[model samples]
Target: MDFYLTALVQGLCYGSLALGIYISMKIFNIPDITTDGSYTLGGAVTAVMLTNNQPTYLILPVVIGVGAVAGALTGLIHTKLKVNALLAGILVMTALYSLNLTIMGRSNLPLSNLPSLFTLVDISTDTNLNTFWIVLAFIAIVTLFIGYLLKTDFGIAMRATGNSESMIRALGVNTDKMKIIGLALANALTALSGYLITQWQGFADISMGIGVVISGLGSVIIAETLIRSLSITSVWLNLLLVLGGAIVFQMVLAFTLSTGVNPLYLKAVTSTFVLLIVGLPRLFRREV
Candidate 1:
């Protein structure tokens, strides 16, 4: 039970990542690999600030800002330079590795003794339970904000920019600018995940972001599958489903670990599971 609860908490922590991926992949049709770097940038920034006794409130904005900048750089490279979107993301992600190291001044930074967002409020007697509530509240706020944004005229334009770039551009909606802003928003959310997770886990390592994009992608895929099956069209419900998908993905991993699989093979298991999620749908559709 404790293991499942921990998984639930972690799933909530990654909710922001799922949403970020949804924005970049589903909305903008970009496989923004900058997720691998901006995520760690968030953790790196959070760990450094907490260690310096910075308030949690102050750190949140900084994490979002830094993450946005990293994303914007990728967007600029892809748009202004007319580079392939994937290659542009790869470039920014690679650069962020060294930049993250510079910010942290080390390969890892521990925050076990430092104050963090999880330590800000005590909602329950059990530590995990308290962390769960805090993470839940934070994710709820983020989801609401994103849901609201997607329903606005600007948000509609952003979505249209993704759905029909040529058409939207023909309508005078600077498609390039929309892509840049969309990527910036996506990465900011991804960074927010890093910020939450680092504090919850009590440390940030330079390598923590490695392969993290897979998890986010998997969650988004799961949500997409559900959306298709149920024919869900409401934007707000779609966002909530994405959050649920993140939790469900984590729960699946927890179940795998509980089955006594070797920890070293965890990544392999993750990859296989994601492959099934992505491939099985097409395979079944082909049979029809």
Candidate 2:
């Protein structure tokens, strides 16, 4: 039970990344691979700031700002330089690794003595329970804010730019700027996840973000399935489904670990599981 609760907290922490993915991949139609780097960059920045005894509240905004800048760079490279979107993201992600290393001055930073947002409140005897409520409250706020943003004209423009860039461009919308804003928003959310998880996990590793995008994409695909099944066309409901999906994904991973499989194969297993999630539904839909 405690294990599952831990998974729930971890999932909620990563739910922010899934929301970021939703904005970039699902809404903006960009497979912004910059997530891989920005995620670690967030943790690295936060860890460094915390090490220097920076205020907890100030670290998040800094992380978000850096992530947004990284994302905007990718957007500019893709839009102005005409680099392929995927290649631009790869370039930014590659650059971020060195940048993160430079920021941390080491491959990992332990936060054993630092005070974190999670440590600020003692909600329960069990640390996992405290994490559960605190992370859930944070996710709720983020979900509501993003959901509300998507209903506004600017958000609609971002969505429309994704749906059909040429059409939006023809309608006097600067598609490049829209892409920049969308990617910035997406990466800001992703960075927040890194910020929270760094403190939650008690350390920040340079490699913690490796392959994180796949996990986030899996959460997104799971949420997409649930939203469709429930006919939940409302923006807020869809975002909630994504959050719930992240929890489910982590729970499923915890269940897998409970089995006697080799822990080294976890990433391979995650890839297979995501493949099934993305493939099986379409296979069944075709059969029907």
Candidate 3:
């Protein structure tokens, strides 16, 4: 139960990033790799803030904002400067590598002495509050917020832009602006997840964000597989599926750990699992 709980929390953290990826990949029709850097950017900002004695409530929002800015910059690089969207993401992620190092003032930052949100609350010492309740609450709130946003007029425009950029442009929608906003929103969510994870883990490693884009894409694919029964695929259902997929993915990880799997092979395991999950549905559908 303890291990499951821990995995659940970690999965929720990853799921939050999945939601961000959904916005970019699904809604914006943009395959973004900036998440790899933005995730660490969020952690770096949160660590720096905590180290400076910033409050938790403030830390979370500020870190999210920092993430939003980073995402917007990436979007601007693509839309405003006429850079290819894919190349823009790579450029931004590369720049964030140095930016994160500067934010932490080193290769890593440890929050051993800092007062985290979990430590402030009256929770059992045996279990981290984040895994059990805080993470759950955060997921719920973000899902609802993004769900609601996607149902609005601006959201429709963004989705339309993804579906058919020329059509949306003919409709008088500023595709560039929409792209920027969508990208900003996506990275902000990714960054926010990083912030919570940093707080929960008590430290931020520079390499923590490696392979994050694959993780997000994997979660999105897994969620689509699990939510096949849902006919009306809206933002709400998509977000819920993301939450579910995150939990499922984490459980798989826990299963691997219990079987004494080598930790060094974790990425290979995740990549292989994603490949199977993605291919399985298509293979079965072909027979149908």
Please, what is the TM-score per model? 0.99, 0.97, 0.94
Looking at model 2, the pairs that clash are none
Instruction: State in Å the error of residue 179, model 2.
Output: 0.3
Q: Count the backbone clashes (under 3 Å) in each candidate.
A: 0, 0, 0
Tens-digit lDDT string for candidate 2 (222-263): 999988888887888888888888889999899999997888
Clashing pairs in 1: none
| lDDT score at residue 154, model 3, on the 0-100 scale | 85
Off by over 4 Å in 2: none
RMSD of 1: 0.6
> Candidate 1: worst 10 consecutive residues by lDDT?
111-120
* Residue lDDT tens for model 3, 179-215: 9999999999999889888988899989989998887
Higher-lDDT candidate among 1 and 3? 1
Best by the lDDT measure: 1
